[model samples]
Target: MIWEKLKEWMGGGEDGNGEFQPEWITLLEKNLPLYKRLPDEMRQHLHERIARFVESVRFEGCNGLDVTDDMILTVAAQACLLVIHRDGVPYPGLRTVYLYPSTFSSIHKSVDAMGVVTEGRVHRLGESWETGTIILSWDSVEQGARDIRDGSNVTFHEFAHQLDHEDGPTDGAPGLASRAAYRSWARVFSESYADFQELTERGRKTVMDAYGATSPAEFFAVATETFFEKPRQLSGKQPELYEELVGYYGLDPREWLP
Candidate 1:
């Protein structure tokens, strides 16, 4: 409880009024690869927002992991990219991000019908919620960046959840720009998610990770990872869903990748 309070204080509390420093911009330019991929217009926009995001969020080194400026900028850039594609929408409610050296364990309380509280153990590399906190394991974040394949990216996964939660709960639908787009998003995503679920249940070979079959929310998150990591494959196999995401994100990553 005390730790949470201190972190809140360091993170600038509910109203994040932290100052953005010039040094952080230089550090981000020197480190993040994704920054180089951005167009001049997008890069300028990202730079300003990312600087503010880094200031508002608190990062702590744990388990001997070094919380370098590069790591923080990289994670922030990736998270902030989702917002850059869409204008006028803020980060919603998220405030702080907790960093760990590796996968961490947490005891979650669950109440049964009798109102008896039970502790459930959870081991995760990253997690994000509507309440505005993101947790990550640095080791996993590094590995995910090193190799975008294998269909596992802790930063992207967690940040995608953050995007989904911006409007409300993550029901695989991040709020679309228009009612027409929202209708199209629902139709395309629903069809693709159902198809993927069936294929996974039948033990068929799937291009994307099977974890995506767990839920509609997971499907969107996993698809976002593949959208950035392996765009060509995703576009070729799931053209409809790919087009939907391209329309939604407002950027075509396939143009960036070789």
Candidate 2:
């Protein structure tokens, strides 16, 4: 079989054997540092989830760059990390992931609280919409992959928004198991967001990024980056926020930290 056809077969699914292609596994292990450090048990789950995500999400190269197996696998690996411990759909609404060779600009329309309409072109490293489409820059994704300690994986960050959107669009609250879960989530996240904004306003250097102060949804995504990348510091500095993420994700990053 030709290489591309082989990749397609292995990535999409194995007829009788549900396993990833050897080359795809090799590329994932070689390129993703976070994936490499996962416990053997977690790695097995990650591999399965990644293969499923790769098969599910339609990958499109937006510009001239041709999407490679490595590229698709890399992005899929990070995305599936969000649901590693939880028994839930990876991305129930997400259908396509658009890749840009570099940072790209798009025209966005917004309606203000006062019912004013505005449209503007904005440049972004990554962006996600409720429509199950995501746009991301390859450069950002590559950098985020290379530096495992940094809390800025575009793929991870963007997919997190999808999780957050599972509940609704107004806030970053995600779908939870029960009413009590929602209450607890709100109590913890609201307090943490307020504290984060207060710290940012006072010019205090927090482990969390100031960008999180933008909104609850942004906070959830930014906090996700920190949860996965700077788990140690995040757990140390923002203990409540840390626990919330650990609970929501069903895994503790502190355990994976070096």
Candidate 3:
């Protein structure tokens, strides 16, 4: 909550005069539009967040791609947005972010109880690890930034997973402020997750992505992407889920809704 704010006030990322850097502001303006739409105070928080994140985490380009300040700020700013109105260090366990020029491939293998091993290769846009490693496709990150209302963001989606992993298992539920809050989270998310799961399975058009049915973890990540990107549509189509997300995030994106 105020921990990050206090740290910034104590000169965590502020300049000698305790001001947000002009260079950082220029990078944000040139790279991401949604950051520009933030309210002034929230924007300042995001600025401090980006500064700390850029300093804390390692941003390495893979496959011959060169990561730039624009790329770093774009990702850091969006990740910090999730915490702008909430608590704790942003990505407390995270240490590294790997950026790829485009979608990357990974091998998926599973063994069934019948002693059968299945293997497949899947192309991915973003992925997060319990070891605090985050991988992303630069292409999707830029695309999400270019069009902010698409209800899809690789960076946001993956970082939400990081939050899910914070308390313990990668279950859809995150660590709430209290026991009552946890109960509310469990009830609302369980009901909505089931309903959304059924809606997707029935091949009906839904506001949330069908991929969310993959698991509760995926559902939470997808919910996060929709909560910020397509706030109006999500609020209209899934008011209950919207309220749940609003409660959890402590920020209402309807002000930036298009």
Candidate 4:
């Protein structure tokens, strides 16, 4: 059954143009604000990607939550947006997604300069692991879907980590076309990240979230959220960084704007 679903998703439906169920379309139109803004061709492509993801990946309900088909589609659609214009299988390294009812607490460990480790429980909305696993708060997912222009989406943020980990460990850089692309990406992201960190330190408003200042890997994720949600603003303020993302993703989100 799963194989058949995968075939249908990849091969396109009876219409031969990447069709989705009418109910699914309605749900997406209501919950995902960006869905309405996408060009017809892109929306079709996204439908195929979401279907492929829903069939291939395992989704589990955590902490007494029950994973529903609607929930899976909602989350998968947002995740598929990242790879909608890229080639190859979607998220080849990913296998499972665990959904929670709301914010959850987990143990967090940190080491000091003295080499002493301290551990405590911290509340989290989502997590992406290199071990083919992701955990998310369903409420947060819904919140992200409802507001597409906020430049903040836990689904996009975590999936960005998944993309960053595809080549190896989670670095600020994902797999680029060539050494030159890699070099350019490194130089641009390094400089942009440093500037982002300084701006964050001064507590100034930024197009990107301050949480991105946490690390290079995190900067990439945050920038991804900004790129998709606030493409025009990001392009205006950070043209170089926006150009790099456009080169990598193979899509210019500014086209989605009116």
Candidate 5:
């Protein structure tokens, strides 16, 4: 009953049926222009997905930031875009989203060929952990939502990592439908990742960002960003990669764009 009351309060309707609010639609249109570009049916589906995500995921404000309904809906709508067309629960492994006011510091460990381990503190826009926790910077998230075409979204990047981790570890691969699907994913991703890295090293222009060259996991995450944000450029530049993502995500983002 508490969740029902919360939903009624957030939806601005006393019915407590968890329907999408008109003000929420206005917020999405103003904050995330991409939401306005989606097809009518997909927009309806996204509303349901956003409601489910907001209900299921625990969102906590970090530092002194007070999480508001506007912030929650904006982030939820964008996060749900990744699984808008998929069946079943979204981000099954995800339990918590910790939001910071801006970029936050985190300690990372790396190992060299000599088996030497080193730790360093680094600033990060977002981070997805295997333990079912995702930390994000609200400022970066808002910027990503507003820009929509840059192929650089903190929510998409971090949520893509969550997808990658669902199968096991955060490898380049997520859970595939069949053995053949896995084979195709591995082949295309491995070869494309190699080529992408070489192109980055040569300082050539690439549809995927240079940061994707860091690792297979990061490459997949970056590719997800490009897939949704810059569908035209990504499809034109890397047809195979685009097709693979289209098949996996079960949606043609090009159809959503003019």
Candidate 6:
């Protein structure tokens, strides 16, 4: 009811659904032209959805982090682009975004075999929860916007987890449009993940980051960062996985960048 009221107050008059508007598109055009490097149609498609997502999520700056409106919109735009060409499925459960000045520590919660709760601090640049809250660091976000080749992006990584959670848990599986797509996705990801793990174990060099060897979930998120950031490298090294991601995201970074 509050969101509905806020939606109406925000001049989202049509159906009071808080949908994106032409004004937001104009604002995005004026503020986020960097994304214009993408094809015109693709840019337009992403603009509206990105604006809507930015509007829907609440952002807070912590530890004196200067959370500029443009910075938030830019980060949200890039993250939302990964899902723009797909069907409409609202980001399940994510509403608040807490931004920090830099990498922060989070208390990790775990249960032992005896049902004892263990708590430990884990330093991170970004994190996403199934309950709809995503936390990110401003420094990490700024770095990501500047360097697209490092295969490290707080926005992409956290949002990839958001996508993965749509299917339930963030086990590297997102909701696919069809069963056939799921089968293909599973095969390529399984093989690539395995190969990356073996490479890491053998202390071999990899184009992608070794962080992917952390877990299947981390593998998916890290691979997503590489998929968008270093599309040429990912495609050259793991063509099948690249194709699967292209199919899922519906946009080819190679075409955009090249």
- Across residues 1-258, which tens digit of lDDT does each residue of candidate 4 receive? 333554665676756664466777888888898999999988988877886787678999999998876788789899999899765568998999999999989999999999999999999999999999999999999999899889999999999999999899798889887999999999999999999899999988999999999999999999999999999999988899999999988898899864
Q: Compared to the true structure, candidate 3 yields what TM-score?
A: 0.90
**lDDT of all predictions:** 0.77, 0.83, 0.84, 0.88, 0.88, 0.78
lDDT of 3 by residue, 1-258 (tens): 222443464484445556665776887777788878888888977766665666568889999999876787788888998887654457779999999999999998988999999999999999998899999999999888768877888888999999898999999998789999888888888988899988888899987788998899999999999999989998898888899889888899998655
65-97 per-residue lDDT for model 6 (tens digits): 767755676577777887786545446467888
User: Candidates 2 and 5: which is better by lDDT?
Assistant: 5
* Alpha-carbon shift of residue 229 in model 1 (angstroms): 0.5
Decide which is better by lDDT, 1 or 2.
2
Candidate with more favorable, higher lDDT: 3 or 6: 3
Error of 2 at 58 (Å): 0.6
Compared to the true structure, candidate 6 yields what TM-score?
Answer: 0.83
Q: Which stretches in model 3 have alpha-carbon errors above 4 Å?
A: 1-16, 86-88, 112-115
Alpha-carbon shift of residue 233 in model 3 (angstroms): 1.3
lDDT of 4: 0.88
Worst 10-residue stretch by lDDT in candidate 6? 1-10
Better of 5 and 6 by lDDT: 5
Candidate 4 lDDT trough over 10 residues, lowest sum: 1-10
C-alpha positional error of residue 114 in candidate 2 after TM-score superposition, expressed in Å: 6.0
Candidates ranked, most accurate by TM-score first:
4, 5, 3, 2, 6, 1
TM-score quality measure for candidate 2:
0.90
Candidate 5 global lDDT: 0.88
Candidate 4 error regions (>4 Å): 1-18
**Where is model 2 poorest over a 10-residue stretch in terms of lDDT?**
1-10
C-alpha lDDT of candidate 6 relative to the true structure: 0.78
